[model samples]
Target: MKGALREALQRARVDKVPVALVTQLEGGAQNLVYSSDQSNAEISLGSSQLEEIRDMLRVARSGMLPGDEFFVRSYVPPYRLLIVGAVHIAQALSVMAAQCDYQVTVIDPRRAFATAERFQGVELCAEWPDEAMARLLPDAQTAVVTLAHDPKIDDPALIAALGSGAFYIGALGSRRTHGKRLERLTDLGLEDQLQRINAPIGLKLGGRGHAEIAVSILAQLIQARYGG
Candidate 1:
C-alpha cells in the first residue's frame, strides 16, 4: 500500500467510517470508496458498479465484481450498542451484545447502577443520556436502546438517537407507557421521526425475564442490522 492510501485507511478506521478498496485484477489500479462520500479512485467506475460497491459496504462483504475484473474489500466499523440505562436488562444485553461482536456501552446517570462490578467488561458512562449520546454521535453502525424507563433519561437519549443515523432505536415500555412517551416526543416536535423508534422493544417471544427480554432485543437488533 502507498503512503497516502495507508494513511487514509488508518484515518477511516479511527473515524469508524465504512470504506472499500477496489483493486483491478490486471493492472492493480485502486480506488477508495466511502459509504456516503466521494471516492478516491485511480480507476473510473460506472454508476452500477458504484452502487454495487455501496451494497457490499452496507453488509461489509468483500468479493469480486461481475466481470472478475475488480475486487472490492470492505472495511466496516465495528457495530456499536449504546444502552441508555444500566439496569438488570442492560447487564444481560451488554454481555449478549459483546458476545455477538458489538462494542457495548452502558450509560446512566445513576452511579450505583452503572458500576463496574455489576457490568463486568462493559463500557460504563456515568453521564446523563443526552450528554453521552451527544458525545458518542451514534451512526449507521450503531444501535441505541433506552431501558431506563424514565423519561428524564430515556427521552433525551431517544431524541438524540432519532436525530442520528443509528440503525436501530428501541425503548422498553408498555403500550400505555409508549403512548405517553410519544405524546412527550410529539410535543417536542419529533412526530415525523417517531416511527424510527421500536417501542415496547424486542420481539414478542413470550418471555418476561430479563435475559429473555435481552435475547428478544438482540434478535430484533440483528434483524434490523441485516435488513431482515
Candidate 2:
C-alpha cells in the first residue's frame, strides 16, 4: 500500500467513515473510495467498471460486501448511538449498545453526572444536549435517544436530531408525558416533526427497572435497524 492509501485508510478509521479499495484484476492497480463523501484516490479505470464498484460500495455501507480481490474490498463505518442523559438507564444502555457494536456517546450538561467513572468505555460530552448533538451531526448510521425525561435537555437534542438523517429517534416518556412533550415541541414549531419521535421508547417487554428498560430500548433499536 502506498503512503497516500495508508493515510486514507487511517483517516477512514479515525473519522469512522466508510471507504473501499478497488483493485484492477490484471496489474493490481488500486484506488481508495469513501462511502460517506464519495471521494476517491486516483486510479485508471473505465467509467463502466467504476460505476459497478460504486454500486458495490453502496451495498457495502450497510454491512461489508463479501469476497476479496475478485473486484473490490470495502470497509463500512460502525453504527453510532447518540444518547442524551447520563442517567442509570443511559449507563446500562451504553453498555448494551457497545456490545451490539454501536459507538456510544452520552451527553449531559451536568458534568458531575456525566462522569468517566459511570460510563467507562463510552464517550462522554459535558455540554448541553443541543450543542453536543450539533457537533455530533447524527447521520443515517446513527441512533439518537433522549433518556433524560427533562424538557430543557431532551427537547433541544430532539430539535437537532429530527433535522438530521438519524435512523432512529426515541424519547423516554409515557403517553401523558409525550402528550405534554408534543405541546411544547409544537410551541417550538416542531409540531409536524412530532411523529418522528418514538415516545414511550422501547418494546413492551413486560419488564421493569433500569436494566430491563435498557434491554427493551436495545430491542426496539435492533428492530428499527433490521426492520420487522
Candidate 3:
C-alpha cells in the first residue's frame, strides 16, 4: 500500500464512507471509488464495472479477474448489531453477534435488566431507545433488531432505525403481533418504509429457546449481510 492509498483508506474509515480500491497490475496505479451518490467519479474503470464494484463494496468483498489488469479491494464500514432489548434472547444474540465479529450494542430503558452483570462483554445503553439510537446512528453496515416485546420502546427505535441506512431491521414477534405493529406504524405514516423490516425476525428454525432463537436471528442477519 502506498502512502496516498493508506491515507485515503484511513480517511474513508474515519468518515464512515464506503470505498473501493482498484489497482492496476502493471504499473500499480491505484484509484479510490466511493459509494456516495454525490461523488461523480471519473476513473479508468467503466461505468458498468464501477456499479459492480459498488455492490462488492456493499457486501465487503473484493473483486478480481483471472487475467485482468486490475483488482478491486473493498473498504467498507464495520458491521454493527444494535439490539433494542435487554431480554434473554438479547443476551444470547449479543454473544453470538460478538462471535461473528459484529460490534454489538444493547439498548433499553430498563436499567434493571440492561445491567452490565447480565450483558457481559457488550456495550450497554440504559437510555430510552430513541435516545440511544440517536447516539448510535445506525449506518449501512448496521443491523438493528428489536427484541423488546414492548411496542412503546421497540416501535420508536424501529422508526429511527428504519429512517437510517441500517442494512437490516428486524423485530421479534409473531405474524399477528407484527400485523398489529404494522398497523401502528402505518398510522404513524411509516407504511412506505414497512417493507424494509424483517418481522418475525428470524429463519424458521422450529425452536423456541432463547439461544435457538438467537441462532435463527443471526442466520437471517448473515443472509441479509451476504444477500443469500
Number of the predicted model whose TM-score against the real structure is largest: 1
Q: Give me the runs in candidate 2 sitting further than 4 Å from their true place.
A: 1-8, 22-31, 35-49, 59-71
The local distance difference test score of each candidate is 0.93, 0.83, 0.88
Least well predicted 10-residue stretch by lDDT in candidate 2: 61-70
Per-model TM-score, in order, reads: 0.82, 0.80, 0.80
RMSD vs true structure, all candidates: 3.1, 3.6, 3.7
Error of 3 at 86 (Å): 1.1
Q: Give the per-residue Cα lDDT of candidate 1 at 198.
A: 95
Whole-structure CA lDDT of model 2: 0.83
lDDT of 3 by residue, 126-221 (tens): 899999888889988899999999999899999999899999999999999999999999999998999999988999999899999999999999
**Pairs of residues at least 3 apart in sequence or in different chains that clash in candidate 2:** none
Q: Pick the candidate with the highest lDDT.
A: 1
lDDT of 2 by residue, 1-228 (tens): 677777878888788666778765556666776643444445665566556667776656322224443357777778899999999999999999999999999999988889999999889998898889878899988999999889899999999998999989999999999999889888989888889899799999988899999999999999988786
Model 1, CA-based lDDT: 0.93
Model 3 scores worst on lDDT over the 10 consecutive residues at 36-45
